[model samples]
Target: MVGHTLELRGSPFLQEIIREVPGGERIVHCLQCGTCGGSCPNGADMEYTPRTILAMITANQRDKVLKANTMWFCVSCYSCVSRCPQKIPITDIMYGLKRISIREKAYQETDAPALAKTFTDLLDKYGRSFELGLASRYYLFNRPLAMLKMGPMGLSMFTRGRMSLTPTRIRNVDQLQAIIRKARELGGVS
Candidate 1:
């Protein structure tokens, strides 16, 4: 991806992220071979591809890296992680960047953050995805018109039994909550 060059500087941000993410220290081993970029499904839409993000981290471009939308664009598919010659946990690193961005409020107003927050809230509450609830809450704030546009499709899905009207609760919901709590405590994805 063509983008602005970032100047190298001291960044406690990068060091903190590396410490938080498992295998994040491997970022220094990136070959800049574009393997992660090539493997990313949404690479074309990112301001910086995974490879470039690694380069930015190495260069300690904390402000630019945190403000960029590349981390939010990641779908967490792990294609880059599996394809990386250096075996960096690119997906986990993306999550770490996301957490930092949210914490710092460095990101621009975008639907991706809202969507992630909605999904996480639903998961925390129900121990499973509540699709209808997610869509309602997400579109309610992000794009009210999209809700109207999706009405027909949502109706069709419900009629066709493709969508459930009621959410299904897991039997071991307490166990799920405990796991989620532990992960949060360990600085895993929230």
Candidate 2:
């Protein structure tokens, strides 16, 4: 136990995670038990399971951990949190990893970041997500050729009334914006 503690103390990556993420201090208690990974619904799809990511963090594999597609694959269902014996906030840590990845531009290969930015931007602007607008903006900005190919599917959805061209603002958009702004401030998200 003493040796493990010394190793944890020496890991700058682990310290960074503990400092930046809420509930991250519990990471040191992880037993390498695979419960968190087993509980994840999308576990198979992730490049690295939650357990492996935690191991990577402890091992100070900063580049591998930050650049992995594991965090982006997390659906934030909190299943891992519910099942973890150490009470680690696995989902929350995934979110923290995502923020760090974005800030560092470590996710250059995936379009998930661009899609997320477009979705959040629309949410901030309209207080609700417009599916058509979201898809249009995401594809137009990130994958223009893909947008051309999606024309038929988009038209089909529009014809089926599954999508609307115009965004619908919430009745109290100002209130929503105020809450969002305060949350950003508190989270230091800018």
Candidate 3:
């Protein structure tokens, strides 16, 4: 039975989104190196360590791989990215997998997806990210406690210009919209 091992072995979209990083091949080249496992900050809690993720990806068991807890636990710390002997941008791969999973509407993250949408909308509105608007929407729509937690150290960060209460918009907003339009078509942004 094929079960869910992989989807017929010729997943073109997987190849499309997966960049040809110089040394990124041979996620199979792993030496059973505990390096990634040992280096991961959240490895202990993961059902699959970074090493296991690599194996699963190479096996073409990506759906199973994406559903695992390790991907969810990743903080995108780039710790594994720097240390890999294969020099694979494993973090980028994780992000790519998350993107596909998200685009398919397969699962959900309590706040990250909506917040990501808001951030993407902000990017489409301007050329870059705006933390203030993102945080406001995140707090208002999802977690009110985040506002209370930040309330203590919030003002100091604001005055230092580390955070802005107002969103800074770029002069050419239309150009940004065009970019988002293209990205949505190319399967990068949803």
Q: What is the C-alpha RMSD of each candidate to the true structure, in Å?
A: 5.3, 2.8, 5.3
Candidate 3, residues 1-190: lDDT per residue as tens digits?
A: 2533334233443343445233344453456676888888999998888888776665567667656666667789999878987776777766666666667665444465677788888888777798888888778888897888887677788888788777787899888788767866895322
Instruction: Tell me which residue pairs clash in candidate 2.
Output: none
Report lDDT per candidate.
Answer: 0.83, 0.88, 0.69
Clashes of 2: 0
TM-score, every prediction: 0.83, 0.83, 0.75
Q: Cα deviation in Å at residue 77, candidate 2?
A: 3.3
Clashing pairs in 3: none
Candidate closer to the true structure by TM-score (higher is better), 2 or 3: 2
TM-score of 2: 0.83
Instruction: Single out the weakest 10-residue window by summed lDDT for candidate 1.
Output: 1-10
Model 2 misplacement above 4 A: 1-10, 186-190
Which digits, one per residue and each the tens of the lDDT, describe model 2 over residues 1-190?
Answer: 6687767867899888887788787888989989988988889988899999998999999999999989888988898998898999989889889989998998757898898899999998899988988888898888999988999998898899988878999989889899998897897532
